[model samples]
Target chain A: MIGNAGDMNVVVCVKQIPDPANPGSLDANNNLDRSSKLIIDDSDMYGVEMALQLVHAAGSGEVSLVSMAPNGETAGLRTALAMGAEKAVLVSDDTLKGSDALGTAKVLAAAIKRIEGADLILAATESSDGYTGTTPVQVAEILGLPSVTFAKHIEVDGSTVKVQRQTEAGYDEVTCPLPALVTVTAGVVEPRYPSFKGIMAAKGKPLDQVTVADLGIDAAQVGGDGAGQKITNVTAAEARKAGEVVVDEGDAFQKIVAFLDQLKVI
Target chain B: MAKVWVLAESAGGKVSSLSLELLTKARELGDTVEAVAWGADTASIAGDLGAHGASTVHDLGDLGTSLPGVSVAAAIAAAIEAGTGPDILLVGQSYDGRDVAGRLSAKLDKPVLTNVVGLAAGEPPVASHAIFGGATIVEATFTGSAPFIYAVRPKSFAAEPSGGSATVAPLSVPETGATNAATVVDRHVEERSGPQLDEAAVVVSGGRGLGEAANYAMIEELAKLLKGAPGASRAIVDAGWVPYAYQVGQTGKTVKPTLYIAAGISGATQHMVGMKGSKNIIAINKDQEAPILQIADLGIVGDVHKVLPQLIEALKARS
Candidate 1:
């Protein structure tokens, strides 16, 4: 059933990240303030949009969302639902606070495993806030599935999924079988804004709420207590000191050249 | 004396610059530094790895034409299980490096420290991460066990040759399994007319201040005249003025060129993070208060339209 070409069930990992445009403060726990209004991360939108397109192309499929946010935040998940995700499974628990990348991957992997038959899992390469860029592949490892990262383009045919993985020099063409995981890069696809009708329709979509206990994740194995890596110190980066500023005299271009010449870069 | 492992990423028998950078840094943090490469014959690059301070090279022969994430991670995990792993494993922050690090983290049940820009030698070896659009630095250390994996960003450390030789050893390649199902069938290299953005010594970038898309041609012309690469800001890329590959910002490619010229770009924090590491910055913007001007070694408060053409003409006349 999972190998059926037309029946592609994709699970997209989304996050409710703090608005990056707004300066966010750290709470006493050293975590980003969750009380502030959160929105669906721009990076995650690429994955959501890619999943929607892939499922649409297959003609018969469903796109579900998996997210782990504190205080059972559905604000971000609702946005993805409005963008056309059929359903969502949000794992929210107070004890899950400060769960690092590995812990988050464990929870997401367990939730995905319980989703009956998921053919593909899609995620953003990294979150705008944390930017760890390792969670999706970690989830793939936990689930014992093949995974690809930095996918700029993806195509699913029969039991195989192919991708154009971005690289420093250019890109590499990669193909993986069904039940694989792929992390999409931002700008890979243009995400559509939620139309008024889609927004209204999203209100009725099923957003299943789960807890660590439901997923059988040991409470001690997650959160700050279980994190293998701990931040020992946080310091502001040395601010760049103001440099020489010159008003655009007619010779401003000449000054720039002299400076470049001084650096021997020309 | 700790043992350190650096994942040497090689393509077509050439060692990646990032791997060499990690090997150079690994030599300082451990008593012994070994590099692991995946290919049919890694002997050709063994000297290059040794020159970067690797005492030994483990070559995983012929892992097929796949992405190498699954097979490499599986082989490394098996080696660790057999007590042949190093105390710490450092991987580059490239696409394939991150894949291997993630899979290894889950397979070994150990968390990976990623986006690390600096490392301090200590009992557990603290890793420094640049966060909040490069505004803050956070120092973290592993608490649980050895063989802690870290994905270090490119250009974090300088690579230098030590004129040393290392012994090359063959590592048994593991059989491809279900997790190794991904394979590369085709590749399309973006036809680049100039030096690669990340490796270019000089980079000339434009932003929304260019007004119209056609104005970007002047930027390309100036970059070409300067023998540099052309780059774009997130604003221009988002405005559909350029492709995503040309973007230079926090969400885009990180560049540390020797000289970075920003034309008509009002430096936002997002854009600054990507090129702030550049050794010399020259910002040409009409707005004097652009955040980029603060970091520019030479800030020109002028319109790019006025400055770029004259500069191009001057360069052309000089040549």
Candidate 2:
């Protein structure tokens, strides 16, 4: 399967997050509340879409998803599954409740390995919630695979992946061999909404649920106690009090200029 | 007292402002502050790092066209294995910084406290991170091991120079194997003028409410009149109205300009986190109840297309 142009198997790492519109709260252990219903993170949709497109471009390949969440939630996976992903591998266990970036990476790396012949692994550069933005690289390290993060565009060539990696100044053309992991930035591609037929087909797709123990990772090393950092205290940030709100009476521009004059910034 | 190591980044032979900010904070938290840098121009930044509080500069020299992430991380991991690591490693949340921190974390099996906005000197070095779009602050400490890694946010501290010089030291990058295979074959820089978004004194940003991609010119024109920079909300950037470099949000650049003007932008929390630190915020939007109005110093409820032209004409008249 290596370097074959036609049959590329891609794995997309997806994250299930709480709605960003709603305010989130911390739990008793100082963790962001995950008891609420979770949906697929908006950022991951691009990766899923990119993977599906890559597979389709290869003419004969399938897209699989790997995710970690609480309560064995498949609500998010089902969304990607509906987006034409062939299958999913989910790692869910009570022990993963307070896992940090490294811990989460460990679980994800383990889940990814179970897939027999994934030529490429994909993920968003960071999750909307818990934007540590480090999991993909850590996963690459664990699997000993080359990785390219912040990919704005990706194209698979034979057994290699070429990426337009985003940088501070601009973009860099980067190339890595197959069996590599790439973290895509948002806007890399426009994600497609699941169609009626796709939604119907997703229900029958295979979703294998595994625990930390099943992955041979010690339960003790994948949870709160296993986290490398501990939350000591949490407090509300100093709030910026409300200022004057004015209806534009056709002269609001004067007020803006006046405000700038006051700040002496204009 | 703790020994601190700051990851310094340089471009065109000058160190980044964020690296200086990190070094300033590192000096305050540790007894001895050192810096680590890569690239062919690493030597040129030693004086700047030293003036910012790093007494020693560890130069990894040039790695040809190979990405610095793998080699830099491997070198640091090797340093730790050789029992020469610092008590705390402060990394600016730059692109390369994240990659090195992540790979090193995996190699050392350590955890990194990322998005750190504040730090305190302590046994384990407590780091404060802003969550919920800067609504809450969480103070955390590493549970195990020294050389606690922290990926700090930009503009969290001021960069103050002490007028000192650094002693340059050569550090070696161990063999990182296939993980280092990703190579940079070409580089492209999108030509941009005016002050940088993160460093500008005055910033004018547009959102989806700007209506079309062409409308962003108003933002640029206004910013230019104010001698500042033009920025964008993630909505516009993601929608292809502007490049990602112009984006201002949690995932984008955090800008704490003296004056931040939001035109036709209903603030999202993600976008708020990036610009909430501005000294003065003025938002103009038709939706009076837009979240951005809540924190803006002056909130003008109006259509951007109308307000922008009038504001631009008024500013032009003043000049």
Best by DockQ: 2
Worst 10 residues of 1 chain B by lDDT: B170-179
TM value for model 1: 0.94
- Candidate 2 chain A minimal-lDDT segment of 10 residues: A1-10
C-alpha RMSD between model 2 and the true structure: 1.3
Interface RMSD of each: 2.3, 1.0
Model 2 lDDT, residue B149, Cα: 94
Identify the CAPRI category of the predicted complex in candidate 1.
medium
- Chain A TM-scores of each predicted structure, in the order given, are 0.93, 0.97
For residues B95-213, could you state the per-residue lDDT of candidate 2 as single tens digits? 99999999999998999999999998888889998887788889999889787999998899999997878999999998888999998999999999988889889889999999999
Per-residue lDDT value at A149 in model 1: 88
lDDT for residue A225 in candidate 2, whole number 0-100: 90
Error of 1 at A261 (Å): 4.7
DockQ of 2: 0.86
The residue pairs in collision within model 2 are none
